[model samples]
Target chain A: MDKVIKGKVWKFGDDIDTDLITPGKWLGSPELKDHVLETEDPDFPKQVQKGDVIVAGKNFGCGSSRETAPEALLQMGIVATFCESYARIYYRNSIGLGLPPLIVPGVSKEIEKGDEIEFSFETFKLKNLRTGKELQAERIPDFLLEILEGGGQEKILKKKLKQKLKELRAKKE
Target chain B: MVRPMTIAEKILARAAGKEEVKPGEYLIAKIDLLMAHIAAARIVARFMGFPAKVRKVFDPEKVVVLEDHFVPAPTVFAANAQKMIREWAFKQNLKYFYDIKAGICHQILPEKGHVRPGMLIVGTDSHTTTYGAYNAAGTGIGDTDGTVAAALGELWFKVPETIRFVLDGKLPKYVMSKDIILKIAGDYKADVACYKSIEFVGKAAEDMSIASRATLSNFSMELGAKFAFTPPDNKIIDFLKGRTEKPVTSDDLVKPDEKAEIEKIYELDVSDLEPQVACPHTVDNVKPVSELKDVEIQQAFIGSCTNGRLEDLKIAAEILKGHKVHKKTRLLIIPASQEIYKAAIKEGIIETLIDSEAIICNPNCGPCFGAHMGMLAPKENCISASNRNFKGRMGSEDAGIYLASPAVVAASAITGVITDPRTL
Candidate 1:
């Protein structure tokens, strides 16, 4: 994982729930990537470029624990999300899927749409290149950082569990 | 000196094998249950993506897989997903597997005795907080977290601050537990309890039936509660007595100490409470039923993990006993589980609803999420008993959804408009 992330900003407002991110009607559809944030911003999926960042207001990703919410963002080439605050499960899902959901208080106010922002995972520092405004973000826990470092929980769990299986086989031998 | 711990702190402390736990501190805790539904198929697919020949779940007994979200396979895509989930459950030899007959994961988990006090449970669905009604620590998880918890029998948690809501005085006639939560949402708004555990205590909470208490815990998700609890009492014990094969006694009940540290306390007297409704677009945009005028509805749905219990059906039946559903509105009633459906049949509640021209669907999450069954058309308005009134939650983004109790839904169906149950 990179120590710093730099991306173009795609801004959203507070209380942008899972239903808005991934509507319930298209729960299991392959078309989910096309519908990501379609209700809230019809142009999001079509216009969002690779390595873009999502900046949103408080309680972002609030509502359902559908992994599809973050999965859609990841599928659409979103590198990370910066929110004033996050709903607990969405935060976990974002991190588990290898998307960094950085908590930067007043971030929604600091960054504007289309602004290029650079965030340092090491210093928890976020700088708006467009506005020249810098802010200190909340630190991600060391253990969670390890998950992010290992390229998310899926790869880590696969490696760990395979090792466990080998150990079990060795003990039996 | 050790500070007095709230129920969440004590439960997490016990699960983590620690003397105490405080807010903002993180710890790895052993999980008693790992639940997944239609979503488990994704976890299984992700797990199988690994090239390990010895892929095994930590404990099949702790895993619960149910097919409730996309039951009956509304689409070929959903059907294929369900097939994969069924095959994986068979291969894993999971101890707890339900194939759409059981019901929503949250409702059937308690009804079938999977939830126990002081246990830590996680699920792929957000409403898993419903288990907290039994004094268990339950929270929602996503697929990757679910997959890891399925492999390792433990998950990490950041101890959340507790908010204590104390309710006393008698609930007025026709006012249900749904109203209490709606009133709270109206006053405090959603996100007031974000990432916090909310503990409901006091006489009114104790007086609520198990089903009603489940409603309180279930809808707390709308308030952004990571976990919600109504202290266990004789009511919970009695409810679990014959329902669970495992021996559960009153001594196993977990409660907060009198001096437990809570971040906030809210005291409410429910004697004067009215029937509350969460209007369209958001759960917190709530208003008393009497204040909502001329809001005509095209559909009325009474079901979901939130309020689909037999008690809710009985309330709806009582209001619709003799009256016919308005010609302008279509009424759909779904019991939460097969057991609740059977119980409603035995009690003649189903017959009364059927006589009123209400459509009774199978016990699944019917149309609450707009996945299947009764979806609202463009510009249509629906008064529903299910939680969540988020925009586009129940089909057409232009459609409006008003959330209320079963009685209100039934009464509104009869009048073709949002009506106070007492007026019916």
Candidate 2:
């Protein structure tokens, strides 16, 4: 997780579903973003640069249990996604995959396309470098934060596996 | 006296090992049951890789794997994915792995009593909320989160706010649970409860059969509800009594507090409502079936976790008893579970459906989400009982799917157009 992230914003509208991010039909493709946001913005995958922040309206990533939705965005160098709210499964997917998707309620009203916004998901605050407006974002639970900081579930699992094994042995004793 | 707990609060608190939980509280709750579909089990297994988190499952009794989506493998790719799940389940010594034989996970879980009242359940498939029909707090999770639950017996959750939907009156004769939910979905919008849970209450909800209640909870996904549940009733209690080893009692039931922390309440009276349909591309684009009577359909499908229960099949059978499908349209029926298949067979629902020139396949998702069987060609139209009518969902992106209930689909299959079941 980046302590501070600064990037150009890519704005999306309400209910940006997993199909738009990583359609199930195209799940295994290497060029994931090839069809990413193709439903809404056909030009997104081609023009999206590294270190970009995607700010979306309500219920971002609504359908399916596709972790590839966030993995594709992260692999394409999306540093963060700020939305009014998120689908429950997608929110967990983002955290487990180490994508910084913060819920800053009304950031959508304050930020615009191509605006320069600086924020840290851990800090739970954002500064609009362009408009000089500051926004407060929702803070996540510590356990989830730990997973994000460790870079994903795999890294966290690597450590927990050893600990869990010890606990199992201790239980037997 | 202890504060009466909402079903969701009660289940979450019990799972989290807490006395009480607030609406927005976050906690790590233990999963009593975690279901994995082949769609996600294979993905999670692949991502974990190598020797993985454990050689065998952390707890075999608490996990289930169902191969419903592309069963019998619509394509070689799907078969290989199923192979991976089969191999992993066998190696992990998982207790319940219903390969293509079992049918959809949602229908099977309840059929097998895997879901019970006041439990914290999770599934890889989004419609896992289907268990909520039994008064459990179950929601969908992705493969990554599901993998964690599989490795450990627990997962974290931000307790979702609750919205109570009170149904005040009985549904009209032609209208079904599908119509009621479609009306709600359209009125509330797909994002109504984006990250929240919705509870169905009142006399109508209590009066509904376990199967009918499932239709309401299953379509909660169409509204993006984290979960949808009804307070346990006699049907649920009776269903669980025979299934569980323990002597069950009312103490196992959960109910909402008089002052439960509900975000909002939406009261609906359905005595006068008509059968509804959600048109293509969006679940919220709903309209009355009568208004869309001119819309012609080339296909009609009845079966999915949403409306493929024995009762649903019986309704369709009643409509198709002496009639044949229209020449221009094809009708397909895929039972939601093998148990449903047997029950429908015993009741002669299959004979009626088959004698009516309907194509009944094994219990599988069956083109519900474009995975396999009975695909639609370009510009073709379908009226289906499945949940979603999303664009390009069934087959070709150019095809259109209109969602209705089983009876409605059966009637429309005979008409080759959208026809309200009331007309029958």
**lDDT of each candidate versus the true structure:** 0.90, 0.83
Query: Candidate 1: misplaced stretches above 4 Å?
Result: none
Q: What is the DockQ of each candidate?
A: 0.76, 0.48
The candidate scoring highest on TM-score is 1
Q: Measured by TM-score, how close is model 2 to the native structure?
A: 0.93
The most accurate candidate by lDDT is: 1
Candidate 1 docking classification: medium
Residue B297 Cα positional deviation in candidate 1, in Å, after optimal superposition: 0.4
Task: Give the i-RMS of model 1 in Å.
Answer: 1.3
Task: Tell how far residue A144 is off in model 1, in angstroms.
Answer: 1.2
DockQ-based CAPRI category assigned to the predicted complex of candidate 2: acceptable
